[model samples]
Target chain A: MFSGLSAFPLTPMQHGVVDEVAFIRLIERLADAGVDSIGALGSTGNYAYLTREERARIAQLAEKHAGDIPVIIGISALSTRDVLALAEDAQKAGASAVLLAPMSYQPLSEEEVFGLYETVAHNLSVPLCVYDNPRTTHFEFSDELHGHIAQLPNVGSIKIPGVPAAPDAASVRIERLRTLIPSHITIGISGDPLAAIGMNAGCEAWYSVIGGLFPQTALAITRASQAGDTQQALRLSERLNPLWALFSQHGGSLRVIATAAELQGLAASPCLPLPLQGLDKKGRQNLARVLDELSLT
Target chain B: MFSGLSAFPLTPMQHGVVDEVAFIRLIERLADAGVDSIGALGSTGNYAYLTREERARIAQLAEKHAGDIPVIIGISALSTRDVLALAEDAQKAGASAVLLAPMSYQPLSEEEVFGLYETVAHNLSVPLCVYDNPRTTHFEFSDELHGHIAQLPNVGSIKIPGVPAAPDAASVRIERLRTLIPSHITIGISGDPLAAIGMNAGCEAWYSVIGGLFPQTALAITRASQAGDTQQALRLSERLNPLWALFSQHGGSLRVIATAAELQGLAASPCLPLPLQGLDKKGRQNLARVLDELSLT
Candidate 1:
């Protein structure tokens, strides 16, 4: 169901609680910017750290603000039962689709992996997108495995990290994957700024963390690429690339979301929960410079 | 509590359901051979392939057969909540301790890592052991972080894999950790055959999959080491080394468990789950030779 640019909004937190007002404003801005879909509580939204009730509330809030726009809820948990429960919650909250990450504790064999997806697919009452981010997962879904996952009845899309313009071996691998999966199944790209390039390389949708910080720029880039204006998309990518690099360099997607929230004046503190050290002073300064250059703050 | 050799018995499967009768018999045999502790549903136990109910039943059965002998439950799961629940169930089922692997999906930050342990520790009544097998989890617990986890109130032990032995640099790092944490926090060595050497190098527990099939030999080696009879322990280790090398050469711990189970007549089909291919004919034959030489059958 995902096409055009999808925004993974930072779940705004104020005083250790979901800041509903700030979150509504963030979603409203993306909707106004013509974002095709909004991903709730994906890695960019810090799904892992949120309590179940908090996550459900955020999904409901996104649905409320999204109106007719599609709200894809990130449905990653350590248990298949939990994932199914979350997917049901997302469906109940009016999510148009759900994104699932495999259980994280043990590296699952393909049989176990298929069983998990089959369990979710058979149970969930909405379109399912398999999230394949090996950086966080320490395990990549091989193209062959992805083909197997695609065979699941409810699986509608695949979300992979976006590739930069310069064709690396990894980029070539992505091209090979595009040729393998069913052409009808959506292939969504994560990793903002490179989203347009990934789209040019046959990805069906672009899910952006940067979209939360700079909705207008993200939308402009996405629309340009959709309208077959590669030159325009490239320019916007260039403008957003520095910030994307700065945020994603040190840790996982949490930093990207934190940076975006900071830029947009959404979250008061850019503090990430344990094990994830916050950006150093130099890193913050670098982000500030990027924001200043973009005239965003 | 795991002060000597620990045997993780394979959960025998017959036509896809847990062969409870075979499983209990295996545990009783291991106990009779003087195994110091019994581990249930470890990687060697084909845990990921088992359903939740099957895994719980295995733990419950192990506890029943264990009697006064310590039964350590492998409480590894994708979700922190599920793992905690498993830990609680394990405690209720008479398990002396629970083992936890890090939340698997992502390379967790040290804070998320500690948070996971804290969640499990706070929720369960029994003492917990942090299972740090990087070969499976694809993540390592750093020496500093290991010390921190060792200090957690309910954390009683650290299970580190025996491979990639502590180098000079690692030895210096762990020495610092040894100074920081309580001396009583048992260090359990996980890689088979290296168990004796690792135990000599400060590890308090030696977990052996081979022990399940050749309990007499496994217990003899462990007892010799416990009595501070290094010569005897070394002799047994030498005898077992060829078998260990055969099982570990291709598939590491999984192959060892499967091969040992076949020799023990515990499992009719010693098959590995997908993504992990089954051992080749030559590998199986080599494993047979080791089992025959050990007089395991």
Candidate 2:
């Protein structure tokens, strides 16, 4: 069910409530940009910060606004019971597949990680995509663990977090993973700046953060790289390097992306939940310069 | 408000509910063992896994059983809003002090971490102890950040996560932290194995996990070390080293402690929340043997 570029939008919030109108508009915009799918609650989607009820509302909004495009709703929680509950909710809300990350407040053992996916997978009729984003979840999936997870029932796709520092090494790693896992399982890549390299390496899809806000750019890069137009893909990646640089420096793109969205007049505020304040004054200046230079504004 | 050994009991759960009867018994046992204080909802207390309502109940139970001993309630949450709310509840439950960890799902900047404590501190009348447990919270407090947090209003103590690897280095680190912060702010040590080293280095208290289950052992170590009986303290610490080895190897003590608790017949089951399974057969055998050798059963 995974292919091409899947846009993951920021969960826009206004005064602590999810801004439903803005969220619907963002999904509609991504759908109109002709992306293959919409991921309603990926890392960039701020799934951890919101309540279950709020996340349920987001799933409905994504499906309502995404038109015919498949909607992959991120279903992550600290407990297996909560994950299964969210998966059931996602399925009821017309989600194409639910993205599962091994998120635990406590670091999970290998057996525990498997139990989480296996139990949740057993409950879901909709296909489950195993999301491997170590930066946020703090649980790194070993190549061996990936092999084990691939054999689980109802798990149809794998979203491999990109090795941004070394794309060549990532390509080699991706090749080995593909060889190890079942060919029936769709392999997708995330990490916006490195998506070009991953797509060039023959990964089937791009689970993209940047694409949610600027789908045309992400889609173009995926098409160029998949079509063997390395030059075009690299050029596009270079153009977005400033934004990627900000994401790297800040340790995450949630704040940077939200800031950019607000600067470009897309969102109401760049505010994240308190204790996670957005970029500083100097950061805002740099972000503004990058957006203006790229004509994103 | 902090001295000697403080016990942190695991929140016993049965059939997906907090076992209030078992919880009260655990607290009463700790008080009987003459622990300096009872820390409800410490890391072993499984504060993160519990709901707000469940946490409130635990606080009331802690106060009910902890007759004369002080009760230090752990108040940690992803948002400052929730943290404040929990702090208010902790105060109402008659807690002597509230332990606060800069708990964030996202990595926080130095400014944000300071703001979290400052904002929460303003609302909390009870003294706040800055809890620096990086392994669980994933947010490390540098010496500079510790100094900053110590200066916040109502902040009267700091719980420094002990570095058990290098006892000498940890002692030096503890000393430097003691000198950097105001003398009024009590310094406590956590991590069962390193508590002796921390106390020997002049840290006022041992925020002990093992103390909850085996308070006699922890208190003996504390009393011996605090009274300048290094040889006796070292002997007690060495006796508990096997359990500490399991904690160090596993990167956490939650499951290991739970297993030992069940083996000693304190709790009915070592069952942690689903997907966080307890020790395997080999681990259980090892833990049982250790407990038996120590005569803790």
Task: Tell me the deviation in Å of residue A82 in model 1.
Answer: 6.8
Model 1 lDDT at residue A64? 93
lDDT of 2 at B254: 87
Residue A101 in candidate 1 has what lDDT? 79
Please give, for residues B1-297, the per-residue lDDT of candidate 2 as tens digits: 588888999898877778888889899999898899999998788887777899999999999889999999999988776787898889899999999888767788889999888889888888888898888788878898888778778888888888544667877777788777887998998878888877877788899998888888788899999899977887888887777888877768889988887787778784577778788899889888877777852
lDDT by candidate, in order shown:
0.73, 0.84
* Native contacts conserved, per model: 0.23, 0.66
lDDT per residue as tens, model 1, B156-176 = 888877643433443454456
Question: Taking the tens digit of each residue's C-alpha lDDT, what string does model 2 give over A85-182?
Answer: 78888988999999999986788777889888888888888888999988777898898898898988888889988854466786787889988788
Per-prediction TM-score: 0.76, 0.96
Q: Please give, for every candidate in the order listed, the TM-score of chain B alone compared with the true chain B.
A: 0.90, 0.96
Among these predictions, the greatest DockQ belongs to: 2
Which docking class does model 2 fall in? medium
Candidate 1, residue B120: CA error in Å? 6.7
What docking tier does model 1 reach?
Answer: incorrect
